[model samples]
Each structure stands twice: as structure tokens, then as C-alpha cells.
Target: ASPQSGYTLAVLNVGAPAAGMNAAVRSTVRIGLIHGHRMLAVHDGFEGLAYGKVRPPGIKGGETPQEVEGTPRCRGHPPRGIFHPPRTLPKKYFEEISTNISNFGIHGLIIIGGFEAFTGSLELMEGRAKYEELCIPLCVIPATVSNNVPGSDFSIGADTALNTITTTCDRIKQSAAGTKRRVFIIETMGGFCGYLATMAGLAAGADAAYIYEEHFNIHDLQ
Candidate 1:
């Protein structure tokens, strides 16, 4: 569509912060702009959307896509408890978000973050029947170190997290090898999924790694 008749698209970051989030947001905004759409960003995720915290892409006045993409951390994230699974939020919450969508003239939404991002998109999709403003198209981009989002083999930040863990573990092993016999129990974050710990164990040559997905006992550890 022509720029004059282009749709308005907004992007939101939900759930916990993760590496590579800024790059994802930058790509979304740039892609939308390239397609002649009016691209806006919703700060603070759904809470921001409910409160009309919509604005043009950068956080600072002089920021550009190049700066945004080069950043190492996420720009922002919704606070915990601000979002729940689909159909679990109160009716008024949906109403407030819908009001902001109408006010912003948003035609589509792109959510970037972890599992919460997925659930938030689902909630918006299911709310379409009750709120016309929510009928707009939605997209979810997985951007968590956890790598726990279902159906996605890999999340945006998972690789970076794994590499960091492997490097650190290598350093730790080197140190241990030079000293008296000692053992270390390392923990990696992956929410309920064991992907990080499991994969990192294989990559780092850990004696054993545990994840929430698997059940174990004292004998198993022994």
C-alpha cells in the first residue's frame, strides 16, 4: 500500500528482558516502515497499551534503527503479573487496551518477548469477538533466553545465553583443573524448559545437568 494509505502497526515487548530483543524490535519497526506503514512502539507492553503509551520508535530523541539494533539488552518489558494466560484477564483490562488501539489507529500488532508474548497475542486474538479493536492482525516473536516458548525450536536470545554459559563453564573447568579436586554445580536459566541446561551440559561437558522437565531423586543424582 501507498504511504498515504498505509496501515498503522505497533510493537510491544512483553515478559522478562532478554538479549537480542532490541534487534528484533528494530527489524519489526524497519520492516513496517519499509512497507509504508506508520510504525509505533508500545512501551511497558500491555500495560502501556492500556494507558495509551504509544509513540514513534526510539526511546531517546536522537535514537535511530542502527542504534536500536546494536543495543545489547531489551528496551523494556512489561512487569510481571501484568499479563496472564489467554482468557484469564479481567474484562475491563481488555476494554482499556481496546480503547488505546482505537485511539492509536493501530491496524496490526507485533509482540516481541517470551512465552508471555505468545499468551498476550492469544488473548488479543480471542478478544476479537468482544472488541472490534482487537480484531487486527497480530504476530509474536520469541525473544527470551529461556527458549521455553512452545512450538519454537529456538528463541532469539537462547543461543547467546548458551554461548555465555559455555564460555563461563570452560573458564570454571580450567580453574578447577589447576586446583585440588573440587566439584561445582552450575545452574542455567530456562524457566520450566531444560533446553538451556541440557544443551549447555552437552556443549560444556558438564558431568550432569538437571531440568524441571525431568524428575529425579537422591539415588539418581548419586
Candidate 2:
């Protein structure tokens, strides 16, 4: 497909920093490019979207760079920006975001982040009724250590985190066994979801695991 025959799409990262964010963006950009779409990488998340801080990836200062080259293939620190509660931002900001989208001629958006990405996409979907510019295609890719995003069994960076925790737990258990310790408590990161802790505990062979989904009292712990 010719460049002129392709859609103008944007990809951005939102919410807290997470592993595998750059890889997601690279895949999005590469796939879009292969399909001959014009891909713009927006920095700083939604704030960048509102302010129009975007440029074609791999373009230094070209008048019109055609393709994004040398996209990062490793884990990247995701930008933590542009995350607000649904319908909490001032109306004027939404207007600006819509206006910027139109100005940039972005026909679609690919948001890569955690639960906040899901909420952000829904917020934009809700705005479609009021702002036609926001009616464009939206895609959210889950990439958080929390693994809290619904509709998916696992998120991008979750497995990596789970492995790290499991391995660390093994080492701690070995040290404790050598010292003749009876009990040890390990913690993992998952804001409201218990996926990480539960999975790590099982993998590390812990006697018990506590999570947000299951309420536990002092008696339960005992």
C-alpha cells in the first residue's frame, strides 16, 4: 500500500512505568508501517496527545519521514503521564485533545499501559458522542506488572515480574532453610489483583498467599 493510501495512526504509553512498553510501541509502529499506515509516536502519554507532542518515529528532523527505523527491541521505561480518573479532567482539556487529534489527522490510536489505559480508552469512547474527532479507532494493550487489566489472563510485563519474584523467593527459602527458620512472608506487586502474589506463592511453594480478592483477618493469618 502506498503511504497516501494509509491511515494516520498514533501510539502512546500511559499510566505508571512498566516493562515491555517499548516493545509494544515498536510492534505497533512496525505493523502499521508494514501495512503502509502513517504512524506517529506521541510522547508523554495523553498530555502529549493534548499538546500535539508527536512525530514519526526514527525521524530526526525530516520534512516528512516515511518509516520508523531502529525501533527499540528491549524493555523500556514507560512514561507515566496523562492518567486521570474518568470524566475528572476539565472539559477544556478534552476539547484540546480532540482538537489536536483532528489537527494531526490521526485516524486511530494505540494506547499501551495498565488499567489506566483501559479507563482512558473508555473515556475517549464516551467523548465520541460529543467530539467526532474522538470517534476514531482505539486499541489498548495491557503492559503492567500489576496484571489487573480485565479481559486478559495475563498482561505483558506480568510474567517477567512473576519470574523475578519466584526466583527471589527460592533464594530466600534456601537461606531460611539453612538457618532453620519456620516461616517467611514474600510480597509481590499487584495493586488490586492477586494474580502476581498468588502465582508467585504457588511457584515458590509458599504455605500461604494473601491477596486483595480474599479478605483475611489476624485469625485467618494465624
Candidate 3:
């Protein structure tokens, strides 16, 4: 069935947390609500849905998604994460998450994260038969420091995380400069994408980077 009016949507994080995850969650929630959809924040990535409940660490619960701020507003420091512990649901609710289409009136899911999010969304999309009575719309926003998600070159936190890597490298480089013949090998997280390592190396003026995009060659560094 097609999605009807006022469809309830759930927002999920699919992988490792990064700088702008909270912002994405906040934005999706606010905008989804403005579009007349009911929004439910699914905490702790897929685990939350699998486990049925999670503690919303820094997030305030009682506030509806419509009330969330869509605009970027800095309130001192942004929250590190939105997960804590102890928010419980009925046992074996993961089964319900997969099959109970109309249980919470959830007909839409907006996932934010990297390849994991993309893959998971596809599985859910493929499993549409499980919820034959509802039109479950699934969308994913790439959000990883890896920036490895195929559709977009720039993921949600990629830019910010790259900047951080460069900034940290700059500080470390400064320290390395004070010492004689000391080279610092800074590591970054990008699995196989290497976007972070390549860009951060360039941004920080590093001598070279061992990235997956190119063959490993010590001569390249030389």
C-alpha cells in the first residue's frame, strides 16, 4: 500500500558516530515533522531497533520532532552523542521492528551513516513484503568520516572530520618540527575509501599518504 497522510517516520543512525550526527538527526526530525510526518528518533544505530530501546544520552525525550531545531544553532558545545542506556521496550521487539509495519504507524525510515546505512536500507527496502500492508519508504544520508558511501563524494561528517584530522596533524607537525629527523605517522579512519587520509594529508601538507586509491610505493613518498 502507498503511504497515506501523516505517516510516522523513524530516523536511525547506522554506524560509528561522528561530528555532525546530532545535527543530521535534529534536522531530519524537524524537517520530517514540518512535512507533516510523525518522527521517532531511533537511538544507538541499528542496535537500538534490534534491542527495542536505548538510553537517549544527551537528547531530551519528551520533545516532539517538530519541536527540534532544523536550523544550525550553537548552544555552547554540541552534544557528543544521543545515546545512554536503560530505555526499555517489550522483549523480542526486533521481530516487531521487522514486521510490525503499522504498530507505531511508522511507514518511513530515514537512515544516516555510511555504507552500513546504505546496505541496511536496501535490505529493508527488499523486505517490503514483510510489511505488505504499508508503503515503507527508506532513505539514507551518508554520514561517515570515511566518506566511502558510493552515491555522494561528500558524506555528512566527512568535511568536518577531515578538517579535524588536518588540524590535529598541524599541531603534531608543529611538535615534530621541534625535534630533529622525527616523522609522525598520523592515522585516520576511512577503511578503504581513503578520502580522509588523502584529503587530510593534503590539507596538513604531509609528505605523503598511504591510501587505497593508489598502489603502495615508498618511491612516491620519496
- TM-scores, all candidates, are 0.83, 0.84, 0.75
Estimate, for each residue in 1-222, the C-alpha lDDT of model 2 and write its tens digit: 435545898888777756677667777877777677888877667776776777777644542334444232112423333232121222446798999898889999988888888888888888888999898889989988999988877788898899999889988988898776366777788989899989998999989999999998878775
Pick out the ten consecutive residues of candidate 1 with the lowest summed lDDT.
Answer: 81-90
Compared with the true structure, what per-residue lDDT tens digits does model 1 show for residues 114-212? Answer: 888887777777888999989898888898899988778888989999999999999999888888857787888887889999999999999999889
lDDT (C-alpha) at residue 54 in model 3:
28
The lDDT per prediction is 0.76, 0.75, 0.65
Q: What value does the lDDT take at residue 158 in candidate 2? A: 90
Per-residue lDDT tens digits of candidate 3, residues 76-128?
Answer: 33454443222232233445566444555667777777787777666655555
Order candidates by lDDT, high to low: 1, 2, 3
Q: Per-residue lDDT for 149 in model 3?
A: 86
Q: Which regions of candidate 1 fall more than 4 Å away from where they truly are?
A: 59-92
Candidate 1, residue 103: how far the Cα is off, in Å: 0.9
Clashing pairs in 3: 55-85, 57-83
Cα-based lDDT at residue 103, candidate 2: 89
Ranking by TM-score: 2, 1, 3
